[model samples]
Target chain A: MDKVENVRLVEMGQSNFIKPYRILFKQNKKDRIWDGIKVHDSVSVLIYNVTRKKIIVVKQFRPVVYVCNTTNNVQEGISIDTNKNPGTKGITYELCAGIIDKDKSDAEIVKDEILEECGYDVPIENIEKITKFKSSVGIAGCTQTLFYAEVTDDMKKTEGGGREEEGELIDVYEIPADECLKFAMDESYDKPVGMIFGLHWFHMYKLK
Target chain B: MDKVENVRLVEMGQSNFIKPYRILFKQNKKDRIWDGIKVHDSVSVLIYNVTRKKIIVVKQFRPVVYVCNTTNNVQEGISIDTNKNPGTKGITYELCAGIIDKDKSDAEIVKDEILEECGYDVPIENIEKITKFKSSVGIAGCTQTLFYAEVTDDMKKTEGGGREEEGELIDVYEIPADECLKFAMDESYDKPVGMIFGLHWFHMYKLK
Candidate 1:
């Protein structure tokens, strides 16, 4: 264990959109103090095609990756001219998910996320709450609930790539049930934990 | 899909200790500007006791819950006098984990987390990188690498519940291999996604 040291707390006002808090605490029997942040909880939905044995996912450009992957050659500060560089680090494959920042039941929020992100009209009753988990405990203490639902092709109401008004550029992709593990767990694939968890749950509890 | 409206970006300065960036993006082919934050990546480790057929986990208070659970009854603002309140909303059961903020390899960071968070002196070679995943997509685009390691009782060099010097109050708990799913997915249990992924992997590949 690292040697414990001084600890202090600095309070910052919350943002209208994002909530960022600076927390200071100690460790190793109160010998060291450490600082961290806490963010909002979220929801991840796994939509399965029962009739076809397939799972639906989405691919998008994450601004966080775009900012983190910035090179020294690229001058800091917002350079809207990123098209000149054509960066690809921001592209990611993830489960249909959203932050839990509304005044509705978890199931209701996930239902909306599914409709908005994946373009599926899944009835609220069809969605099953699998489990709730922290997105990351060490940094942000935000929790995420995992959900699963089986849908048929008939449930496809509109071309689902998220609402156009939010500036979301989503490409929906479906992989066969048997091939989900190989694709989701592929080391080269930019798969998130929620997607992997959703795949595992389908194979263990739904498929068999 | 909720109608996405005019979107815009408001660049915010980065912090020294914490990297909090304000990101604005569009959705659904619209020009609606939104605001969000970007955080650092992290790692989660699942330690298995091969001889005992049990999995190791840790419990701690979450600052997010401490802040979210506060209401009219609980006084707000940096009241460092929480010793009188003894709050309990942040307590959660999760896999041994840590943030990837250092200049070490993912394997090295996880190995260090195992030793510091769980008291297991595991060899780096014994740790297997299962996969990498995003902690949250809509909010924090931070990614986390999931690693699995099997340790024998002899590897426990010290009592691990997090370093006391950092003001960490952790309780170590172990669930039998056969009963992990029941406990981890028990809706009532405050289980995290990494633990569920670990148990499912153990059942799918290790056990059978």
Candidate 2:
């Protein structure tokens, strides 16, 4: 553990892609407040290919993971050579998800997400709510709802890899049902909690 | 589903507690990007009272949940009243958690959080990592790690209800292990995915 000091609000900025705000709040049993950020509410979907007995997954480069990887490298005294996209380590295996600030139902929003991100036209009725939760309770307090949807080959409409106009370069993958848990749990897998939770949900509730 | 138009970065602001950052991203089949916010990363812990056969939980007021309740009111054509904290409906039942940016090891930070927020002093060696994932992949992109720990009566150090100086008015609840699953699964339980996941993990891995 490192020495922790008090935190407080210092500054904030906004961009078309995202907004960055800072907070100063206390730390280390101190009376002062330290700084942190707060983002938006979002949703993540677990899409099961019931017909194929497989799981639909997505992989994409994430700027946050990239920067975090880069930061870790710098901390470990690794030499930084590539000035261009040095944080290329951001690619992540994640569930289909999107923010929830729109004026629409969670099912409707996830239905569109399924179509655009995975190229499946899952109906709103097919999507079941697994649970609604706050993603990161410690730093930012935003709500995220997890959804479950079972789809078959009949639901496939397009080669879903996300829209190019949105600057998204998503690669979609489908893992066999028997291998889904192992694949998601592999130590080498670069995955998020939502993805792993989704896989676990499939194993516990859907695998019967 | 209602019509969803493109979103643009509108405004950003900072308060003593949280910072609000907005983003404009594409949504629906439309070519329009939607507006949303981005917060920060966090952590949550599921503490098990091994001797007592119970799970530690926390309850507190959350402005975000409160606002969501209030916004639902507006959508339903309910007139807004009570200018002085009208969004009082922001209470949440959640696991014990905190931020990771404090320079402490995940075990150390969560260890302190468990003690501070829930009034338990479980040692670091007893804490186990369940999994790490992004809280809101669609928005904040910050990571949250879930941890599990088991303790006994000897671990009790204080009447855990969160520290007052930090402005945390937390109510600690310990549900018997026999009732943990149902309590966590109750539709009325205002819990996060991590908590439910923890409970599920407890059921699948720890209980038997």
DockQ of each: 0.22, 0.15
Number of the top-ranking candidate, with DockQ as the measure: 1
Residue B80, model 1, lDDT: 39
iRMSD, all candidates: 16.0, 14.6
Please report, as a residue range, the 10-residue window in candidate 2 chain B with the lowest summed lDDT.
B1-10
DockQ score of candidate 1?
A: 0.22
lDDT of each: 0.66, 0.64
Best by TM-score: 1
What value does the lDDT take at residue B96 in candidate 1? 88
**lDDT for B44 (candidate 2):** 81
lDDT of 1 by residue, B1-208 (tens): 1111111112223444444445443322323332334456788888888879888888776554444333212222353334433434556778888877799999999988888888889989989988887665555566688888999899988778777555566777788988877776775555667777887887777763
List fnat per candidate, in order: 0.30, 0.13
